[model samples]
Target: MQEAEDLFPAPAPAPAPAPAPTPARDHSAAGHRARLRERLLTGGPDALADYELLEFLLFAGSSRADTKPAAKALIARFGSFAAVLEANPLAVQEVKGVGEAGAAALKSVSLAARRMAKGKVKGQPVLASWQALLDYLAIDMANLNRERVRVLYLNTQNRLILDEIVHDGTIDEGAIYPREVIHKALDIGASALLLVHNHPSGSPEPSRADIAITKKIMEAGRNLGITVHDHVIIGADGHVSLRAKGLI
Candidate 1:
């Protein structure tokens, strides 16, 4: 009772500390995109730099973070921005933080590019747009990890009529059958054909088996009265045309 004031003294709780603000990392990705969009709007075609163009392509995949490091890393690893876009999905994913989403974005861009290239020559003679055809083929084939042999069945007008994936396996000479190829061509009503395949080792150089297979396909097409336009071998490095190389 004598020390009532002391006994009833109120205790004070400590005040809560203020939260520290999160430091802003350079919004490099957003800034980069903004600059590119501005340039594209202000200037006409060819306004953006190659790296900036690549950066725009990459922005779709890395919406949350800076893509400059990733794009730079890709160009650095693959030697060029074109090479980066040409890299296979697995190879593209090997870069840090380039997960499935990034892979899909890159592949979608490739597919779209191919569609546009094909559209340029659609309903027209294929020979007239050979560059477009080569571009479509190179972009589509350069990234494959496995060996795949495909046939482009064409009509008499040399317009694309059908694209068939005939065999997917190791590139041994025996895997491709001229008889089977001819039969498929007949079934598809193709008057002409283009042979295409990929090399997993990143070398477009034709193996003995590759050359033999090309010869067999050429012979079969000839006997069936179907023209063989080209035999193209694709690899990560690039593509080689057997007909162009005098191998067919």
Candidate 2:
């Protein structure tokens, strides 16, 4: 019995007393996120820098991780908070740590902004709210990489009836036909219309082609007794009104 006890070493010395549990990992990141939330609630959005605002937005997509690096990376890539919000979904997803969920969150903000701007002119006389109209158009088209031609169909009282895209691509006479503009106006029974397009070059100056196309549409609308209110060209810098410049 003594030899057996020595060989077994007295039941392995009670499994060496088991090891003590290690403390949990530090939660400094969670603490920082909580502080950010407090500041946002107490100080409002203006209290934060662009990256901080973006970080707050990123939290919706990545709740478990520190989002400062992702926010800073997005701002660095897109140049501004607005630019990031307006960026194409695929382009936005190119940023590191921005997957489908993050892209959706960013796009949701852009859509809300557009709807809010659109509300300022909807069902109202667009000419009366000309500044609001300009703001809405700029938000919709200023940052686009390609040209798009849209027509705002207005009722007899100059209230906006429908805002429709007539052509989407390079803006020229061939792409934007005078007949189509007039026909659409007649179809919608719009008494007046506004021609709008954007310049991808960031300059609001109308080229000779732009002038020629506007005149063609103006003539067609005049023949049809539909008033052409204005041809507005939007750019990243500003917008140009052809009627104000005596081009239409």
Candidate 3:
């Protein structure tokens, strides 16, 4: 008593027509990335141009997207790889195609370079390696768009025990508390302190405010048995030492 339509069942709906095979995934960028990696590994420091180096860093962020455009955009926007790295993470992301990941990658390199340069001077007598210390400071503070104060605390042996960034300020002005500067030295048992800061104006010359603060810190440290060895003002072209100029 089954109906004829029920008996036939429409021939299984013609097997639902097998879904067309998905097109093969594109591997062109992957191939290029592999070649670039090989070249980087084999070639020396000159292996890649600035943009290419940026591409290498961006690859860490994006797996499938082509990084070349991002790299080029960053270089064009920031002017150089070092400038790109020095930029604030937020600023770096202003470029098209670069997100937080890309910005972080660039920052990691910047931090690594700073640590490496610092290692050359750390644990060594900072005064004896005066040029090395200068090099480290310049690398760290030269490109800053605002003022930042770093205090290098040295034990009685004149070896660096601590390097701390104490304060950051606007493009044209900054402040550091004399009591706090001395308190940190006393707390760390540092016999001497080397103060460092950068000028956003590209000049290492000390302002009246800079001299006033340096003297105040020195006076505060004098009573506490901590010596203010120098206050170095870092700039793009050169550095000035308060002690060298007989200001402190």
Candidate 4:
């Protein structure tokens, strides 16, 4: 079968399959994240270092590069993990690699911890759960940059009813009125009061004016039949109870 020899040429060979394109960035850190999570789950809370805890926090907040560097930087800047959580959101955001979302994540943890501490006081005797109350208040007011006055109103059972900010600046300078404070308590049907204020200077010790003004508030509440439980001064150092100090 003498076909024309030149007519039929061999079919062209198929193009070689393209090799799989390589990923530009390494995903080894994801494996590290998994390991950290496992360590957290199996080794208990204290297993992870401060930097590692911070790193885990950044995972849900940031979509950038490896969070280890950010975590390390945060620890270095704030000096500790607790300090990092206690820091102001603006201050936290000022750290490189920690954006607004990351800062919010940190602050949300702080709020969650405070809420958990608060739960320890809720539905329980406030006097009996003093330490838990202190923990809650410390989380809330310890790291403030300016003095603030808050009032914790309680029912007859000594359970917290309302947490109100009565003053925003220096307690001595603020126009804190005892009549208004008593009226608020009366309006809310609160039978007791726990005065709270923060010291920016980190000293929980009460000043002379602090004692004097507290006495005034106590006297005002006394006439109104509302028991003033305690005036707790919160600071970075700790909290002080004026009643414990014999000041009110």
Candidate 5:
């Protein structure tokens, strides 16, 4: 009671202003990711646009930077979201800032999409779902670094009985042997067959070797009473069908 100033002792020096609350750093990137995740979960499939879906995919790898530009750039470069996902890992690396993380993200997404498509076609007559089969083949074979010749062996019902890799190397006529193709089909007890190969150059247009191999396979299939359904050449850009072009 001797003095009011002495009693309070200057309010204890104002408690050092509470240390300014540590300035509350921003976490916009993390916040954005959380929001995107919520959209995917609550809104279902229609919740995301093409780019938004791509953005969500990139978030797995590029969580720190803005993903909008990367997503847009990918679609712009590849001409579509599907094409970007189907692109080769090296091809995807061509994009700026698309390092190991980005390429891995795209590759994983493409592989997951392929698995989903394969599940849809499983235990079903593949011939009836020709478009689905082509889409699956296109996504799987496009953008490979090396050529891979795969054969889908079918039974009498045109169902996929076996899928085998007959040859993997450069896609040329001499690289594949008609006898080997015939023997593999026979070994698998396949009554019908569809041939597929990839072009690393991204041009599905058939080369002389492509045509020759198709002819040899078709001839062998004929002699063995097996149907040669189609020869599909997949490239980075698009796919070519021998049956559609009347080459088979």
Candidate 6:
């Protein structure tokens, strides 16, 4: 019986293996977003770079997505934060990941900026806050791809009455008639007017055509006892006042 038991000895128990180490959690993206938020709260918008500011804006629209790439791409495509905000919604949507919602988000900023600027100039003498008026024009028209002619009608006090777009796409005599401007001024009871247009070429230098048209409009307004305050040309680089240059 002892010999038979020895032949069928129990097998040794299998050795236990050591447990594998758990991988570290990757929180890098979350950590970055937190840091950016902290910096913005502490330092205000001036502390963040353009792309960083754009990233923050994108985060509001897409909380879970990584927004750095989209922000950088927008800035690169549109040239600046202001430009991106002012861009057409369709143009903005051309960028990957910037769908309708993202484009709308950017457009909302532009609309807000315009409203704020208009508030500063409306019901106040535009010349009294010259810088603010210029800023409003820059924000509204500087980045436009086509030429636009706007008329700023003013009351006797030089306070803005009506801001109207007279012509868009091109500013030829056929499109911008002196008679039409005079009729509008009369219709609005504007005692004075400011003629404004944008040059998409980034240069505010007035063409001969621009000078000639301004003279025509000025003459028309003068005959009716309406003051032609200035003919301001907006460009991407900066703005130019025909009055300042003695062109008027």
Considering every candidate listed, which one attains the maximal TM-score?
A: 6
Q: Which tens-of-lDDT digit does each residue in 1-248 have in candidate 4?
A: 65775588778899999999986653587778878888999996699998999998988786645889889999898766777998878988888888888998898898899889888988887888889889988888887767788888999999889889988885335445789999999999999988888887889998888888888988998998998888888988888888887776
The superposed Cα distance between candidate 5 and the true structure at residue 35, in angstroms, equals 4.6
The C-alpha lDDT values of all candidates are: 0.78, 0.87, 0.89, 0.85, 0.80, 0.87
Candidate 1: residue 215 Cα off by (Å): 2.2
Tens digit of lDDT per residue, candidate 5, span 1-248?
57977776754444455555575645687777777788999996689888778888877777588787778888888877877887777887788767678889888988898998887777778889988887788777776557888888898888998877777786442256778877877888889888888887889999877888889888887988988888888887888998899876
Q: By lDDT, rank the candidates, best first.
A: 3, 6, 2, 4, 5, 1
Number of backbone clashes in candidate 1: 0
Error of 1 at 34 (Å): 2.0
Query: Of the candidates numbered 3 and 4, which has the greater TM-score value?
Result: 4
- Compose the digit string of candidate 3's lDDT tens values, residues 1-248: 99999887775445567889998754799977887898899999999888988998999888878999999988888766777888899989888888999889899999999998989998899999999999899888888889999899999889999999998888976778898889989898999999999997889999999999999999989897999899999987699999999987
- Between which residue pairs do clashes occur in model 5? none
Candidate 6: Cα lDDT at 184: 89
Please give the distance, in angstroms, between residue 224's alpha carbon in candidate 1 and its true position after superposition.
2.7
- Lowest lDDT 10-residue stretch of candidate 3: 8-17
Q: Which pairs clash (backbone N, Cα, C closer than 3 Å) in model 4?
A: none
Query: Which stretches of model 2 miss by more than 4 angstroms?
Result: 1-27, 170-174
Candidate number that wins on TM-score, 2 or 6:
6
**How much does candidate 3 score in TM-score?**
0.76
User: Each candidate: RMSD to true structure?
Assistant: 13.9, 12.5, 14.0, 10.5, 9.3, 10.6
Determine which window of 10 residues in candidate 6 has minimal summed lDDT. 168-177
Per-candidate total of colliding backbone pairs: 0, 0, 0, 0, 0, 0
The candidate scoring highest on lDDT is: 3
Each prediction's TM-score versus the true structure = 0.70, 0.83, 0.76, 0.80, 0.68, 0.85
**Sliding window of 10 residues with minimal summed lDDT for model 5:** 11-20
Scored by Cα lDDT, where does model 6 land? Answer: 0.87
